[model samples]
Target: MRKQLINPPQIYDGSPFGMSQAVIDRASATVYISGQVDWDANRQVSCHNVAGQLKKALANLTTVLEASGSSEESLLSLRVYVRGELGEFIGDIAPILAQYLGESRPSLTGIGVSSLAYPEILVEIEATAALK
Candidate 1:
């Protein structure tokens, strides 16, 4: 399938990291969004708390989805990677997820990791969605 890369100006550019923010499969009308971290335009993790980082990451993810011609409701699955204990932050995470996803209950998975791409990053979210 032919692919199209999407890099919205609103989010941190991932090209320097050898990745695009999202890729669209023209033939299948599907979008694969790269893992979005709580990075500012300067590629710095400004949030010190998990909740704050998660909020920024989700916002970045939304920007990618929109740039890919998809919406939150079109999400097919989400893979969340957390830097620390998943249980320690579930309470802070659940509400943010609900705010972005609303009633759309797509497949979701949470994985706890020792660390993320950046030492300060607490969360990263990647998603797959059908084009709207």
Candidate 2:
């Protein structure tokens, strides 16, 4: 897949916090990753709190990206849904997110919702990526 990750020189980069100004995908294959939660291989929620769930969700996202032949670099955009405010947890996710995405930090949008598909789900992540 072919793509361009653009960040204007005039604007301060937001990658360290997991964000980007724009992503251009000229690839032939585009993958729309469904929202991933903290469910383990047994199909049970693995995390009870926001911090735990955040980590689990990132791990789950990695699995999906690998299965689709698209890695974090291929990611063009991400939508994060959170059940409630996670004051300190946001701080924790930043570094982990930087590590997770490596050199690529796709555009991100964080949404706060009253509830999610599952009540136990403290966080859910959906992503879009392009690949051959």
Candidate 3:
């Protein structure tokens, strides 16, 4: 299990997360996935908005998981990156995570940046899954 944490009350007050103050993991098999974006088969970013990008990125993440004989339930952590509009991205992606993860909200980190490798790509997601 891997968990995310942002320490100090001053940093987490009013924050939507409940991480402790450390990130730790103990698993048998760990799968690390590269950052995923909203790229289509043609290798083109298919979305200009955070919501669309998140959907596609999640889809890609699932594909990778399936190929590894694992599922979302095996996930131990996720790192999300968004270029601008952090609030909107959170609103769009959090519900999806809630729906897919059920009661197990894996440790996660969200980073807001100014841009991505692809101009049309609004968000990127990477994951770590533990098969145990």
User: Whose TM-score is greatest here?
Assistant: 1
- Candidate 2 C-alpha error for residue 80, in Å: 0.9
lDDT of 2 by residue, 11-120 (tens): 33436647443344555577666677787744488669776887888877776666566778888888888887645467766676778778888998877788997688
Better structure of 2 and 3 per lDDT? 2
Report the C-alpha lDDT of model 1 over 1-132, residue by residue, as the tens digit: 398999998888788889999999999999999999988788888789988988899889888888888999999999989987899889989888988888778899989899888788889999999999
* Top candidate when judged by lDDT against the true structure: 1
Instruction: Evaluate model 2: give its TM-score.
Output: 0.72
Worst 10 residues of 1 by lDDT: 38-47
Error of 1 at 121 (Å): 0.5
* TM-score against native, each model: 0.95, 0.72, 0.73
Full-model lDDT for every candidate: 0.89, 0.71, 0.68
- For residues 35-116, what per-residue lDDT tens digits would candidate 3 score against the true structure? 7678664557667778788888887777666655567888888889999867756777788768867765789898998988
Clashes of each: 0, 0, 0
Model 3 lDDT-worst window of ten: 5-14
- List the candidate 3 regions with Cα displacement exceeding 4 Å: 1-28
